[model samples]
Target chain A: MSSREIDRIDGSALPLRGDNIDTDRIIPARFLKAITFEGLGDHVFEDDRAAMADHPFSNPAYRQARIILTNANFVSGSSREHAPQALNRWGIHACVGESFSEIFRGNSLAIGLPCVTMSAADMGPLMDLVERAPDTSLTLSLSDRTVTVDGQRISIAVDAAVRDAFLAGTWDATGLLLDDFEVVRGVASRVPYIRGF
Target chain B: MGKTLLKKVWDLHTVRPLSTGQTQLFIGLHLIHEVTTPQAFDMLRARGIGVAFPERTFGTTDHIIPTLDQTRPFQDTLAEAMLSALERNCAEYNIPLWNLDSENQGIVHVIGPELGLTQPGMTIACGDSHTSTHGALGAVAFGIGTSQVRDVLASQSLAFEPLKVRRIAVNGTLGNGVFAKDVILEIIHRLGVQGGVGHAYEYGGTAVDAMSIEERLTMCNMSIAGGARVGYVNPDQTTFDYLRGRRFAPQGDAFDRAVSWWRSIASDADADYDDVVEIAAAEIEPRVTWGINPGQSVGVSERIPATGDAGTNGAVAEALDFMGLVGGAPIMGTRIDVAFVGSCTNSRLSDLREAARIAKGRRVASHVKALVVPGSRAVLAAAEREGLDQVFREAGFEWRGAGCSRCLAMNPDRLEGNQLCASSSNRNFKGRQGSPTGRTLLMSPAMVAAAALAGEVVDVRDAL
Candidate 1:
């Protein structure tokens, strides 16, 4: 019904603890002037590159990886869509965190970046595995909601609705609204003074 | 059963239920900006529909207008055309406009409250997401699309489904250094951005009650991003006082009557909620955005999360690959090249005052370039009267005129290639500050001030 396109990404397990990861840092605000999200992967941290020349992203260990896992309170300021656009553009499958900010998470999800939340306790083993093998590439099994790196399973919790959405591949809430519109309208009309509203 | 503010406002505004799964809801106020209005106005012309109620509609230019060099025939041709179209449309429709020359000119959200157009117990609509900013005045403001914009223009009524309501109350006293911005950042962090989808947030509690109207406005403004169709703080003494001397607020006996009516509409003490969240003020801090989004943040005292420490969303391997950041770095000492203080988010006099307090008697780092822009001509005048401009200029901040400078970089004010800036404006998404490689660090104005002085991500308290 709207011009905005939506996507549904399958669930994945990711673990990382970083604070102050902002929209500029996520995709860098400078990339917004561009007509498209294409090629944004290079500028994800245009601000950080000048600070740390040999950053891991500059290294070759991680490539073609999608999805970001972080601790509580991910994406905190500004309602810039480029952050999620960049991640989604650059093959980032999804973002999982203990908690997420309102605007960042919404904008991300609107454009198909699934922001999944898991408990801290459930994320410990996965985080521990990453710490021990810093360069290890891990895979998250969405069917069973398990994270595995080098054959070892990692514990992580995910909400059922989010998991189902990921598996079913639909991120549009409006569809949900429309599906229940008849019932919602019926109930709304019954309420005095609300039939018109 | 808990009824949301959307339900209450919708019920009050409904003239009739439509067969198209939409209720015919009445709109008390309609706000418009430049970018989205042109097509709607054209559509109105095509349908031969003049605005049904011109008095209820207000217009301003923000999205496409240049903040700097606001002279005629703007540098961007598209922007210039949009501006002219808005002016032409406003004139033809007899709609009141707050053009660049008008004292009320600024972001649509900024001007609504100043003009007293946004008020308690009203349903407002604007062709912008941040229309939620008006909800602070206790109005249920909805962000509509161009078609909806046209609908309001042609009919003065819109069809809409109902929504549930959530009551979010923050009790206790907010400590100094922490602000409404931080409080909101904390809320978004805890609840996630989509937590309020299909819900209206009714903010209350001792802490919210104690906030100045401006502070409360900040909290409600970002509710749209959090997926709230509407966010409102119940009208009280604070709301009434803020509107008392304004142009649109009622006067004398009428004021008294209005206040009584306003008070009656607040959620009663026993009002139920579909959901309620309580956050302590003491837990909040002078918030800043470190990642490319608003929610990826922590206290100034905290360090960057280690890759592994980032929960399932951390995707350390991937973020580190893209962001060029390693795990476990200290976010505090991160160097910055530029510092900006302005935007609809935090460009008011109070915001300037806080930044000035940190900048006074301290020189910015030699390599750092700092800019201070007010939200409006009035805010500019107030800051000048208070000598805040001198304080900033003396501290090496470029004291510029009022506009949405450096917020979205539509003007000359922007970051160079890959320049790291500590910015008070909202949104840090890459290139949001203009340069294809520019980086923005979102923070409170005070934090920007502190960072300007240190040329790094230093805490404002440290500067204090």
Candidate 2:
């Protein structure tokens, strides 16, 4: 997957609301054995998907849902890139939660999976709406910092600099770092221990 | 107000501020292991990038290394390939690797401090989450993902957002048999898993100051479990004494100069902090995780939390169903099928010695399968030198070589289906110990030894 500027996502919401939904629960360690993240979506919440037939991901209506609404600290725990990869591959374009883990949010942003957070009070009504109308298409507009559903808007906030990356289409740190190769080399050359390779 | 040690280190290493609200900080030491670096090196190769500062990077085989019969052409093909990929990548890039054959080889975290490569006031990064283990020596260290690892390898720097420093002070004295592992577990229990979000934990206070380096390392190693990116202790005379004679530490006059600088970087008496939390060390008991996550813990003497007491009723019921545990019951005496004592968390020399002391005259239960895997090759040798290995072996535990054995189950050491293991590792996530249905209960090394002897989770205090 490559980084793309994500300004807006419009889709029916699939709500897996809870606190501290850690990466291990998102994609367990056993699924990370693959050489690459290929086919990880098949195992996303594998145990949960197996045990709870009623898990939202297994619901026929939410199968094509592109936005996941969840509670605080979503994607917390181990620094496994597979967590975001699984969400991305499973057709989640964005995650709207009360909070997200630092590393998990970083990984998601790198993969173009926008993880956005709102206040607990704001999240309660939003989750209520999503749960009430699972098929209602919600529009998350990064440019305006709001999520709109059926002409009604719920204003949201993302880190200003992170929003700038999305709006400017420069979220790829690797690409930018790669462009400044000479400067990196200059800094590396001056380090006391790094005289030569 | 004076700056905290974390701020001082960040100020020292800042290269530039990015438009993305992150600072590019020069990494003093870049450590890598077999599991996370292969794909990172592949990213570099794809980008036609060589390691810009190869000398700052060190490689080791840990995650996938076998603890028994580690011969050429490993029995597990994927494990051999991963190790080979690391060897080939390091060789091609001129990065020094402490291969399995090298005496310097061990768990990446253990080897760094023991070899004296990890020092005070440096920024250390590794692809593994437990890299915070190095912070016990007064450095600012954290784990990074594979992409960040690639960035560090190619640019010798990382773009990182600043973290608020939360000073967590544990005062008073700990009870007997309550180790550093219990202290951290108690902290996580009180703070909850997500309480440390967007903050770096600076451990302090009388209890923290009195801990040995090994005990401190154990505390910092699990800071991630509390959702903190970094955990550290201030450098002091104890830190200097620990590094004085190590192979990579500065020698003679250079050592004195280094010590002078290190002393300057310790948190000032009136340093500023974003938040302060105080805990009474006396309140902590030997902690045992009763649920899937590290934060889901109870004291050995306490009852499992009622399902209603858990924040979400669904999560509580789900965890109980998954772990085959009943709510409101005592945490001790939970039967276990396996016992493992090894990980970057609790696999140092002192940890092994403590476990061996508990196992000396006892025998493992007939129904239990127990193993002792040291953190590094050096730790393995040190344990054998003191006959700790013999003590464990005579008590029916298999003494294996050094590696991250049974930690994440990336190696041959793993649990079978539905088997519950009392492990000294950091994580207790479902399926973390190999089998999809396997269960893991996180505890201290001596607790694991006692569990092995009893064929169930038992109080180490009783054995003591």
Candidate 3:
């Protein structure tokens, strides 16, 4: 494992207080027909934002923000990989929520993005800060497994394996499978081979 | 101490439990589709591996196949490549493939049971998650990843941990207009999306046992979103009868032996369970999704729940904001602009008949665009036989060919930006119908017909 702490993404956090913002809402299912994940950032919430012009993320000031903090159930719906790929194309580096759908977590992890789950209380102040000050640089540290919005430390529990995978930048699912195979083989080697001559 | 469907299937398939905390389980049938197989085949080619048991596996195209027009050299280059790749892989492996022109062509989940390929006592695997839909026939069907797909193709076995099984028993009788779609929507709503997270649900009791094979398939299909590995109903006369004459199923004496084994694999009447859930059949109504997820649901008679009324479940608040729905408005009067009736969830001939029965002699509301998609060619032929297509066409519903149209919007069937849809398909996650801002309200096939006629959310009972 790598010893260095992976650098956290810096951004003016875009806080969406919505519930059940699903994979399609994150990126519409129409975009999934495309061959690759390139250029999907252009269509992010294309219809939702088209109706609601004043939404925070639609504003030009939030263009460079790489971190997004939303309420729980941020990613729910069909297990479409295009959802997170759209977010990544939109330049999203990390997402923090109270909870996530199991399929969403698996897809996000496969592509090297971290979905951080924080306490609802921890998210409230940060949401307020983002809405109150658009220019505020909120630092989200996945390595520390905490959310610091406008310099306020918010404790959020994270799975050690998820943290280590992101921190070491060793988020290779295929590599993980290889390691698993070796370990399984090692255990088998120590056991009796009933039929193999 | 529990004997769930998972245990029953597991014991029947196990050769031995390996030292690596996984069981060496035999797979009796393997189903594949175009979308997830191209990459898996490439991986196999790189390693010089071939499918171990060619006769036990089958392939078809669904995900990227067009329902509207499937001309040569598709407008979608990637889709064309995917189809080409899958065709090549199937040919290279000498596996029987039912391509687009075949009379049997349709969604993998739909075709498996139609041809009697899915049967009781069979351990089935597909690369797509909705593979569980075939479990309606009492088979143990689960989705696996691409690597696992390669694993199955190479070895005809999968190594995996055992899953707990939950027995969802529904008793009593269902009210008219409350179809199978309502039964599944109610199950997901009452259980919440995560309720079945680590379990395979074995649906039984008077309700499941009483249902037609098609209705049972709809119930098993949605178990994926409920977080279950798979779901099934036990095999019986209905199952054996369905498989008895299919092209792929065993014939005559062999079939007799197969039926005997299939019957024995069913959970014993005295079988214990990890958990038992009781749902009254009369308690369910024509349901719909009020917010972004299937969990964010309400009956057609109820209104959307407010985030403030969510009472500290953080997910509810998030769902509400994403949905932009006001909690207090009655769902009954909510206007709908589109109505889609297709997908592996509710696209069978029986589903169309239920919808058409309600839609008979009634036109869709002027502003509402209604569509009726058959699950497969066989369903289309069967519907045509019963004049169900005429009923749909007279009702102002677009009668389309077979495919997984608008379920995930990989094809042309999609909701224009923010168009709310009364859908009979399985899911209702935000933007699931092709429009990122589109809202989906899931319900029974009958309810979708009623909603389409009224051009808004309406009680199916009123239409009935």
Cα lDDT tens digits for candidate 1, B1-464: 53444556667777665443346676778998765567678866765657767877998876655555778888766567768888998999999998888878877777788878788878888866677788787888877655567767776666555667788889899877777777877776677555776678888889999988878877887776465757889888889889887887776777777778677667767676777888887777777666655555678887666666736354445434444454577778889999998877788888899999998998999999999988777788889999998999899999876776687776678788778888876565556788756777778888899899998888777666
lDDT of 1: 0.69
Per TM-score, what order, best first?
2, 3, 1
Error of 2 at B247 (Å): 2.0
- TM-score of each prediction: 0.72, 0.95, 0.81
lDDT string, candidate 3, A1-197, tens digits: 22234547677777777665665566665555543456878888776687688875698877877888888666655555566767878878888887776556656765677888888876787778777887788677876667676567777766566576667664533333333343433433332111111
Q: In angstroms, how far off is B335's CA in candidate 1?
A: 0.8
lDDT of 3: 0.76
Evaluating just chain A, the predictions reach TM-scores of 0.69, 0.93, 0.84
Q: On a 0 to 1 TM-score scale, where does candidate 1 land against the true structure?
A: 0.72
RMSD (Cα, Å) of model 1: 8.2
Candidate 2, residues B76-113: lDDT per residue as tens digits? Answer: 88777778888899999999999988998989999999
DockQ of the candidate models in sequence: 0.09, 0.40, 0.15
- iRMS, model 2 (angstroms): 3.2
Off by over 4 Å in 3: A1-21, A34-75, A81-100, A104-197, B14-26, B46-50, B76-78, B145-151, B154-161, B310-326
Residue range A1-197, candidate 1, lDDT tens digits: 22233233333323445644555466543344432345776676565555566654453433445556677657644445556656666567777677775556545544556676667776665667554555667565555666656777655555454444445543333333333344444543443222211
